[model samples]
Target: MITSMREHKGHLYPGGISNKRIGVYELPDADISKYQRPWRAA
Candidate 1:
């Protein structure tokens, strides 16, 4: 997902499912464009 962040250039939200007995949690939205690293050679 990090690889796609550069192209998104917008807000990013987090979400995931938990086991039956567990509850879900909400995460703060991130403007991750500034945090994206430049593409590098492998």
Candidate 2:
């Protein structure tokens, strides 16, 4: 029974696993434009 169990365990497939790298970037503050509008007279 022990030998049969070992053989069955060996036949089992491995689970999915990945070793990928990810990159993140941030924009500079000076490059951003300001959104300002003049006030209209009432």
Candidate 3:
């Protein structure tokens, strides 16, 4: 089984999962767009 994940717009979200055989099929790449959160000075 293959698990996928993606991060976009400052939040992380689950993309998808595949349970197919690895050798017979090509695996997809995970789409991810990570954002940096701003920190406030105390």
Segments in model 2 whose C-alpha atoms lie over 4 Å from true places: 1-19, 29-42
4-38: candidate 1 lDDT, tens digit per residue: 21223343433334323322233346456576686
- Estimate the TM-score of every prediction: 0.20, 0.19, 0.29
Q: State in Å the error of residue 39, model 1.
A: 11
Residue 20, candidate 3: Cα error in Å is: 16
For residues 1-42, could you state the per-residue lDDT of candidate 3 as single tens digits?
436644444444444356433222223453333435544557
| Cα shift from native, residue 17, model 3 (Å) | 2.6
* Model 2 TM-score on a 0 to 1 scale: 0.19
Cα-based lDDT for every prediction: 0.39, 0.29, 0.42
By lDDT, the better pick of 1 and 2 is 1
Mark the regions of model 3 whose C-alpha exceeds 4 Å error after superposition: 18-42
- Give the count of colliding residue pairs in each prediction: 0, 0, 0
Candidate 1: pairs in clash: none
The lDDT, on a scale of 0 to 1, for candidate 3 is 0.42
RMSD of 2: 26.0
Clashes of 1: 0
